[model samples]
Target: MKICVVGGGLSGLVSALELAGTHQVDLFERKPVPGGCLGSYRIGDYWIEEYYHHCFAGDAALLDLFDALQVADRLVWLRGSTGYYVDGTIHPLTTPTEILRYPHLTLMEKARLGLLTLRSRRFDVQALDGITAKDFILDNLGSGVYSSFFEPLLKSKFGDRAGEVSAAWLISRIAIRSDRGAGGERLGYLKGGFRHFVARLEEEATRRGASIVPDTPVEEIRREGDGWVVDGKSYDAVVSTLPPQVTADLAGLDIARIPYQAPPA
Candidate 1:
């Protein structure tokens, strides 16, 4: 079988490698290099990410993939700090002690907040989908707790749309973090940048008879008979991993309704 994979991001690269064992694979990437968001740029003598990214210990899928690729040794975990700025002051807010010491909430409010965290961890997020985080926090910890602490945090993170965020998202986020082990609470980083992992994937795919073409963007995709043609080139199968707008344009399909939001950083 012959397979054509569009985009050379992490998903596409991994897909090509997984399929190369029994199928001839061709990967196309518009950028000059692979890695997509995982790619980095130079900052003086060091490399810096365009956006902040760190992996939690519970990311077993990523850890397993790295281990299978023989690059697990490159991962390094670090104990980092988290701070909150409230009322024009920066407060250390990492541990339970710090949370208790937080001056923004009263002792009863703090206890209620802690109980809410524990309950959120144990509750099913889907059950809370109909609620908003603001309402849920206010209901559990009171309006004062919401207005004094969580509201500001949400505003700082999500800006004007903070109130629109669903309670399920908040619950899931807290639940996942609360379940992490001591080491899992820490963050992990790949040495030399994530490009190393991307390069390794590309090398493995090519070694397994996959052809990777960079700087080749697919302008069109149309179904013909039982196969697909991408940019006028025929392929037995096409797997598109482009943005929804790009996919619609390539396939010449009507644009579907999509929720619009501020561009993520």
Candidate 2:
């Protein structure tokens, strides 16, 4: 079967790679280059990630993807430090001692924060889908933790739409970062850069007979009888890794709106 994959991000590329072995695949990316959020820039002899990313020991799928791409050996485990900047001060929150020393929330607030971290993984994420992160934090950890601690983070990542973010995403993010050590959280980074991983994925997928079309925004997606027509080309099936709302708009479907935040320019 011929398949059309829209939005050539990591998910689209990976899907293309997986399906290209037995099916004809075409991946469309609006950007000049693929990788999407994992996109990078060439700095002289090296590639630097446009957005910073790191993995925890718990990132089994990511680690597995690295190994599958034969780039696992390039992964270097590092102790990543974190800090909170408030007023004119930069307070380190890398270790337990530092977290305890930070003078933001009260001891009780700190206790609640720690408990939330510990309990984050056990949360029923599906049940949190209807609730906002701000409400969840406010209800469980109080306004101080929400305003002083999590709000800034949400703002930094999500910008103005931070308040609309669901608690499910927040809880899952906290759960992902729960792995810690004596010094700090153990983080994983590719030695050269994640660009190598993205390149390897593209190469493998292409070698397996996938066509990657970059700088091509999918303008149309309409039903063509039993199959689908993307732009002017028809495919046996269509897989969209684009944001749900964007896909819905392209297909001319009237679905409930899902709030989305585009990456910063």
Best by lDDT: 2
**Candidate 1 wrongly placed segments (more than 4 Å):** 43-47, 127-131, 179-184, 254-256, 260-265
- TM-scores, all candidates, are 0.83, 0.94
Give the clashing pairs for model 1: none
lDDT of 1 at 208: 91
TM-score of model 2 vs. true structure: 0.94
Question: Tens digits of per-residue lDDT for model 1 on 1-265?
Answer: 7788999988889889989989988999988877677766677866666556667777898888889888889899877677778668998777777778888779999888778777876787888888989998888779988898778878887889899888998887886666433332577888876766778999999999999999888787898899888787788998777676777878887778343353342
Q: Each prediction's Cα lDDT score?
A: 0.80, 0.91
In model 2, where is the ten-residue run with the lowest total lDDT? 256-265
Query: What 10-residue stretch in candidate 1 is worst by lDDT?
Result: 256-265
User: What would you estimate as the lDDT of candidate 1?
Assistant: 0.80
Our tally of clashes for model 1 stands at 0
lDDT of 1 at 170: 87
